[model samples]
Target: MATRARPSACSHTDRVFLYADSLIHSGGVPKLCPGHGAMPPPEGQNMINESALLESQSLRNSVLERTDVLDRVKALSLLPDGMHVTTAMVATYFGVGLEAIKSLVKDHRTELEANGYQLLAGEELRSFKNLSGLQSHTRSLAIFSRRAVLNVAMLLRDSEVARQVRMYLLDMEYLARTQPVDNPVHRETVSLDDRIDQRITHILGKTVVPMFNALIETSGEHRKELIALRAGVQRIERRLHQHHTRLQRLEGVRDDRPTVGVMAAMDAMNGRRFEHHIAKLLHRDGCTDVVVQGGRGDRGVDIIGLTAAGQRLVVQCKRFAPYLNITSPEVQKFVGAAKVLHNADVALYVATCPFTPEALSIAAETGITVVHRGLLEEWSAGEPLEVLE
Candidate 1:
């Protein structure tokens, strides 16, 4: 018999034949070739159906889009020197949890590396972790992270994504640096009473005095401005008196403790002969038994006084700057000292500045009253201290 030529299996033409064969076998009705004589389905047909092919292409496109987005984020996170972005900066930007972001970065390591993006170094990441731990909030972490990501994106990518990321990160950085860090400490170690006093002083120095002075300078009519200024001063005086009364009540229990160095500084600042002027004034106003620089064997109590009704009061005086606020731990210390030293009925915190909102809340909850600088002045001047409450 004559040898018929067999088709080469490795040829493209043969593969197409196999594809048509498979398609016909898989419930696809075999049809005659349109131009050529009857032929087999193409090899590509065996490997993929039209519907599946489209779906696969769509999936691949989606993956690419996601990868691009991640890449842009990473590029913005880099610096001009090509250092990997800091995790803290990135976490702060994204408004997400730091741990959560770290985990995401770890989980997506392969993806990031494949795209030519490097993960943040261990040391850099550690700093972020420490900051996040110290700060104790997800909002800060997210903001930090987002910023880092934007820097990386700027360095790695030249696309519009990079531009947008840079702009957003810059705005965020501005806000973070300009605005106050919210409750930087999870637990406060400073006195609440001191914080309240400090806040009062801050308001008087920064807000009250400056405002009145400006009004006085700008006012055309001397009498009107003077009257307004006098009224404002009186308001402040009343507040100070109330703060002093509260301080007297709180400090009545620690009568024999040595005074702290800050007390002298405060006395000088206030132009008083002694730091105990507030206590003395209160004593002269029938809140007697008030002692200055008193309180023995007490860790935090500064002044001690006793009401006529025999209620012992423990006081802690704080002279702090306006920027440095007091913490809850400080309040706790004074309260603990009062319980141990005098078994006082009330705990009072008097500060030259303001108490942080957190400290104020804690004082209220713990029944530790706070007296600010304004109130202290009112009490010292023998004015009604009722306005503060």
Candidate 2:
């Protein structure tokens, strides 16, 4: 399939392109340009003196060496022909959650499909369905081609796995250009330094390079580690916020009557006792066919029922201490299992404790109603169950 050209690594300007071309041959030595940060010389500057040329050759060698090491990283494919990787494979390689990968694909369906995302169909899909025993299902499997993977890596801004994949793709592109050719005549005519310089020029102008503007020169692997570290810090901050919210909820509403009563009621109920209470509450809310799915394989939804309006409703009850907040992933999973898997028209996520901001956001997006203590009190007092529009 024909794919659109990736964005240029450098800025999208004629001057940047021209300067990027000469940067490899001019040796992008550490220089204090007036406006540009660690960029090449201006358009009309003659900075490629004899000494600079030698340094450019050395820099070219170093880039090639680093690319060679990247070539040995087994996660990268080595086939001369372009290698296609599936979305599942990419997720596994990066140690990212599969649901997150699927979410990215869903959000960028058009762009990703244009860049070589394939939905298994016709003979291939039929064979897969037969093998996987999904013969009854109509949905086709979505797979990402090599370029499509790179495209997604560029767009998955929140994932550290995608960052590493970006680094890998850049390194592989560099290696492909720098690899020695088999043509003896061409090899002899073009010196290794010239070939390396041309490859560098191509990378600077054509490829979408990750911006690393530090003073210290870093290897691709080292740069990937740094990105992963930065992502880790962000994750830590998110976790801390969740924890802080949990702490505040657990201790913040001590003086409030309704919240305190809810906490006391939750503390008194064990697993089986909690299910019994949930069933009673759901029954009292005019739900027929009320079922307590409190077993080991309850599919994450603890309660199932039908409203008076004959709408299918699913509920996930959490009988936890107030310090524990239900997370976004849990909400996402519950929403998926309820609405998608169980054919629920709407869902109620009941928890004694308050929800995290991320969880509330997910609930809002997925149309799942979060029933906190305050809402539960209203429901128990004969108020009809109402979801926010």
Candidate 3:
């Protein structure tokens, strides 16, 4: 990733050889480097493979931000899917215990899923196992892409392989910062127009959306029209997103798709959209018969789903401001409907906001899994809750 001034003593051929050697030995995916067509292992190939980075959150952030390096850490043996690896393979590649890998996934499920981690279940699980030639009796399987594996490298602490990858990333970063750029003409990723578009989207999200909500709430006669108007804005926003995705794909790196994940997309969602989003996440996590039930006369239940193990699940979704907190009274209503009326085997109260201490206590005593902002984050990131089992 570093472009340096060629030293007079180092011939172009020697530079080519040296750079190629670095990439190969560092286990980076082979790529044709520019000019001499030699590739240097993208800085931090191993960083994605290991989960430990000397206890520095900044380092992890750095690795994630520079996903251009995902393909550099080559030598990944993928299954029949050609795009994903099982949890077992990841453990073998990192030379750590399977539980260790699972632990990292549990701790940083949000980040990993943002990159490409997934859990396969039901028909998906059966198909994957059949295609990959795996014979396992497990009801679900965890999988990761090269991108997700690289994320794990940044979080894992005990692997020597991971350490080497981190060291490689550091060297390249130092060289990049210190070396002079040959091109004097400035290059930019986002243009002025693009920034303006993003700003407009933010205004629509933070301002216009709440206004529509208020209008719909107060105006009994015009409520339906206001809702339709809001839906049109949402469609426009999604179309703009499609255009943005096209622009991103047209960029230099083919593997480097735009970094937008479901979490960021959820920020633009209104109450109804948020309910559907949670329902989709539950389905992705292997829930069967998942349904969104948010509406008048829904009796406090916003979602209904079945866990992979056949347990009945009922969920209540609250799409409040992130800074707000759910009160015990709010949670108590969900408990009565979910536990007493529906006889839910597992009840989850999911909110975009945090829960009050008393609210959390009530959830605990009532056996309701409180999926506050943090827990919902991980669940959205692809990690199923323990109760889902």
Candidate 4:
């Protein structure tokens, strides 16, 4: 007795089709086809392919992962009604490009507005408090313009953001004043130079100096505070001298030319007077090795002195009109020359004005200390320079 054959795995419909097709080709009546049955094509095959299904799943997971990002951006958009967000703050929070964040907010302007988020204009942002208010304002702006947001984020995340910002602000202020003059004649005018210098000085005094002062005061030790304070003062004096040098250069006065001879002579006399005063002040404060204009050679090194601890210091002085800003290269060149000529332990860059951040960074990197106008003023006011042993 033969056992009944086990039903084929293929569906009846599939088997019937196969049998019919074979008969049609052979011109004979259709018969059941052997081994025609197989598992039905994978379920859901008709609606979506396997690859498509996998892709869909992946997309769902991505959406889930990005939920937090979207939520953060949304929450930041609803900061206190009166409070403003900065592009930097928003980019920082979302870990996105500042410009991208800014563009997102800009593209969704209506949506953000509906949700009580307002873009803080550049001017308005500047008016906000420096610490938190400015940060919030930057964030708010970043969410409005992707470009702004990304750029701001990049700047905020940068290690040298403060220096870059300070430089940018200076450049902008410089441009604002200089752009109005088109003619060579108008550009070379003394009034223009004076105005630019005044504005730069104002910015240094009002903005940068205060920040630096706060940093100096925050130092825990007397020696640290004194060093920081002296460095800050030197920075300011360098900047003022730089401005004056730039003004002279802009007026086409060659360094060796006699055209500015009288002016140069006047500056030299004023510098001597200033150095004399500084020397007297330092001497009165129990500093014994205070030497003024002691170095030989035409190099910029102005004074050579020794601290009470026998550490030698070489100083460079600039007595230009106020608001001149000095560059780092000048300071570096001076320091290099001084090191060679005096073999000093430290180089002190003394000026009647301030130095740019680039100058400050260069000094910091090269182990050269700076003494600006503010430090001179402070020292003259009988603030003792705490000795570090």
Candidate 5:
């Protein structure tokens, strides 16, 4: 019979706060700004009562039982400080309309803002616009921290989508409380490293577990000799650790709008997937017409579209490994194709990786705008691109 593994030294208290970390700051959860949005119909605090709280909490537990809930909400990312999700992300996760979410915020503006709904303004707003590649005329953005989302979910009773999201929140919180992840040290919370470790464990179970099991049973008298096998396992662990560390570093370095969402997407995608990602990003950035010509022979351009301003834009995409740098010859060809052959008003050379100094110099001199990881992050995250002449 297989032995039941002993539980690690992780605390239940740690697990309980996994979702609570959204609010309940060290000092205390603060109240929302007054007059931020229209009042809650003068219903007073009676609309959401203690029974609603209990029901929501019960529902939270119910949602937690399903294991794939987190995976379904794909926007969950560990920002530099903590796990973060946005209002748009919440809507997407619940399969609700964005305008519905906006309406919810409009109704419960004070309560949500108290819970950490951020209204971007001034330079921060401008920076966000630039990073997201948003044209000058796009609507202003409203971002909510994870806690704010939970508050809105709890009170949102009208929309079918909101009802689903409320259940999702309850289930997530309950799961975090009842089923803490079993790590080596028994961490109650899930972080990027924990997720990476889970992947490593899965890989090892598929490839190394059987080998180790057989070795343990067969090597009886020769068990001491098996010490050498430890080296191989250690190597595998080291490689996994290196990959995880690299990903965390990349995520940590960026403190921009839509930070990890764009970076993670770029790093994880390639070839046709990368092409589609670019197209989707363009659409999100308000491009009226965007097309991807995959497996093509017409011209050097991989993406052709019209910018929101009706400018004819030709985009050539280079999906490459991080180690590979784009060179000047590649730039020169695209420049000619975009400007001369296609008769485009703007030419964009986009690469998943970095560009060689010579390529950068050539692009600058020829007025061929190069979009590398940084610019790609900006554009993909919804910043408007300023097409160089």
Candidate 6:
């Protein structure tokens, strides 16, 4: 007897073709200057944002380009494929609760399935897990194509960032439909210097960063130096990214943009300053009488406060480089401090970087809120931490 074939990373190009056919039949997409075409309005937009889906920026699957466009709404991190994103990643991008994303998925499952939403399990799931190095123990995982994510943005009503994304899509669509201005400047041409900068940035992000990761893992004698060098390259990339953002700015960086928010301020601070920053963030969210320990005789907790609803809150701050991972031991120590020593109702282990898979597992098992780099960016940008609510 013949067995069924396992699923692989199937292309969404068929959906794109079908959507294009629908638009053609309904006169939905606006025809543009020769080769150009207008994107549909936010309400009935089909498929995904083509601006983001363009594979021109892929450095042989090493670096994903068009990040500036995606980050306009929020910084959206992608997996190695650069085409797929997890449900949690979608939640992070929208600055909403994970449950909220699940709610959207539940309500729009049919439409999303038509646009490349997938629930992976069994042999296919195991294959993807090995390739991506994902750490979840769940029997299945939910993943979205870029088209499905854009579909979510259309239906999502809770986030200001999502609202901005919808508006941006609408505006771009209308702009493409309008007549071209003879006096208007176009960005189609790449300047020599700008092209050079793009090359350097691409190399640093795709080639050099991974090289440093490998070196740091194997080079025990100079791991710190390797990390430091990696940090310096990351800083350069960030500065270049800022420059690119200025070039990409439409009506200037919007007030809701996170790049101008707490992340920048916190990045400039030292350990003591980070403690105060966390305290102030708590105070901003209506925590009363928040106290910062300033690294003196503080066993593990760096900040303590009471929530607006009169619940005890304890936080431990770790301001590490984004490339570095917070280990399980550090989170374990915080758990002991927050629960055993302080008897806190809310325990937050906040860090500037990501946590190891083991660290995240510990946080989940112990009910600690792990505010890694992505969530910290959201929290710093005035998006209330879901745990706080």
- Return the TM-score for each candidate structure: 0.30, 0.33, 0.38, 0.32, 0.38, 0.39
TM-score of 2: 0.33
lDDT of residue 313 for candidate 2: 81
Clashes of 4: 55
Error of 6 at 306 (Å): 0.6
Cα error of candidate 2 at position 387, Å: 3.9
Q: Quote the lDDT for 374 in model 2.
A: 50
TM-score of decoy 1: 0.30
State the C-alpha lDDT per candidate.
0.45, 0.54, 0.65, 0.46, 0.56, 0.65
Q: Can you write out model 1's per-residue Cα lDDT over 1-389, one digit (the tens) per residue?
A: 23335566543323333443443345343333344331222222222222331234332222231221333223234321122344654544343455755675565444444433444335654554443233333333222222234323433322333333333333222221222223333113224444444345434434444444444434434535344554565356445633543343333213342222122224234322334755765566555577766445545577777764567866787765422457878877776777776687866787765566778888888778777654554454456443122
User: In every candidate, how many clashes are there?
Assistant: 84, 0, 19, 55, 13, 0
Give me the runs in candidate 6 sitting further than 4 Å from their true place: 1-264
lDDT of 6 at 348: 94
RMSD of each: 32.5, 24.0, 24.1, 30.2, 21.1, 16.3
Candidate 4: stretches off by over 4 Å = 1-269, 294-299, 386-389
Instruction: State the lDDT of candidate 4 residue by residue for 1-389, as single tens digits.
Output: 23334456844333433443343335332232344221122222222222332234332222121111222112334222112345556655554566865565565455445433455556655543332222342333532322222223223333232222223232222322332233455444545336445445544444444444444334334424444444464366456745554444345333343221322222334557766756665567555677676446546666666766778766777775433667888987986777777787867676756688999998888777777655644554556555312
Clash list (residue pairs), candidate 2 = none
Model 2 alpha-carbon miss at residue 288, Å: 0.1
> On a 0 to 100 scale, what is the lDDT of residue 66 in model 6?
27
Backbone clashes counted, model 6 = 0
**How many backbone overlaps does candidate 1 show?**
84
Q: Ten-residue segment with the worst summed lDDT in candidate 5? A: 37-46
